[model samples]
Target: MSDAQFWEMNPTATEILNEVKARKIQEINAAYTAEAQPLIKEYPLVEQQSWTAQNTEARAYLAWHADQQGAAPGTPVLDNILMGRNGETGTETLQQLCLAVIENAEMFTQFQQLTGKRQRLVKAVRAAEAVEEIELISW
Candidate 1:
């Protein structure tokens, strides 16, 4: 079954699942942004801001676009940020968002893919986490 279809079919279970999924997503997002804010801020050119998962992909695209338009890839461009936020320029917001996305893509994608009612995603994340812990212990 399609992902949306699977979700729709079991609405009751999905509701609870979605809640837990959403909470996890929020926690991931919050942690990422909180950690990234200081890193981006340390670089004078990049702006520090919080982003939601729904807008991340579009934002990343915009960031890439802006960089191509003479704005430095990692630098903050006021026009790009405003245009991206307002959808004024097809390239601007997507550029800023894109850069932001690239900076946090790994964590964001994990949060996105794991967001569902199924147990597989959780199992995978836990497995990965366990592996990481083991690696760290060995180190």
Candidate 2:
């Protein structure tokens, strides 16, 4: 509204305008949340694939780790495989296994960093009081 028109508004009209503005803001916030929710939910899966693709050794270890029922890090599984124990043949050389473990560790560290950044973005989105503030947030 023009300053002159707004200044001339009756109390009832001003009240109604305020209510309309509040409602519009609520709708904008809801829409932003709807758009952001799916991205938050699917981020891990999408990032995992992307990260693994960029790190070939990490990808190989991931597949092998899955076949081993998702072995935890710091386990003696690699040693056992090297020693030909636990029904695991010494198929992978020590150097290959070591590289896989190192690469996997590095990949995991990167994943955690990205995930933490995403979580912080989520917090910023939640705490924002205006559409413009929320719009500044990125994944």
Candidate 3:
């Protein structure tokens, strides 16, 4: 509030200011709680980083393969490349490429599961009416 406004409401200004401060503090606490709650309790940061890195690397591989094949980057291209249907073998052997494809698919599935779980948890946190309720949510 401006100086003039504060002085004008002087009689109840202090009380109103204190109430606003309290509400602000509560809001800050709630935000902190929501963020501090880990999506995965064990090695949360490492797990999250691993998921992101794997997903990124897989996507990059797909894009690179797509560019090489002159087609769109997606599972179809990945399948064709792995199945030796593209006839454009580069370095890795068929077996090795197949294994990598399987690994990438598995990682993608895990990443999706993690993402869905985190989204649900965030929704629950936002729906919580109190900090205590938010605190109850876990990975």
Error of 3 at 50 (Å): 15
Q: Please, what is the TM-score per model?
A: 0.26, 0.36, 0.34
Tens-digit per-residue lDDT, 1-139, candidate 1: 4567756776675454554454454555565556556445554542333344325544644655756666444433444555667774464444455555565655645554334323443444334433333233210
Note the Cα lDDT for every prediction shown.
0.48, 0.54, 0.54
Taking every candidate in turn, the Cα RMSD to the unseen true structure, in Å, is: 14.1, 12.5, 11.4
| Distance from true location, Cα of 114 in model 1, Å | 16
In model 1, which runs have C-alpha deviations exceeding 4 angstroms? 1-11, 42-139
Best by TM-score: 2
TM-score of model number 1: 0.26
TM-score result, candidate 3: 0.34
Model 3 CA deviation exceeding 4 Å by range: 1-91
Query: 1-139 in candidate 2: lDDT tens per residue?
Result: 6556755765475454454444454555565556545544655665445444435544445566656665534424455545763255446764465565566557466556555655566666556655566556554
What RMSD value applies to candidate 1? 14.1
Error of 3 at 115 (Å): 1.6
Range of the 10 consecutive residues with the lowest summed lDDT in candidate 3: 72-81
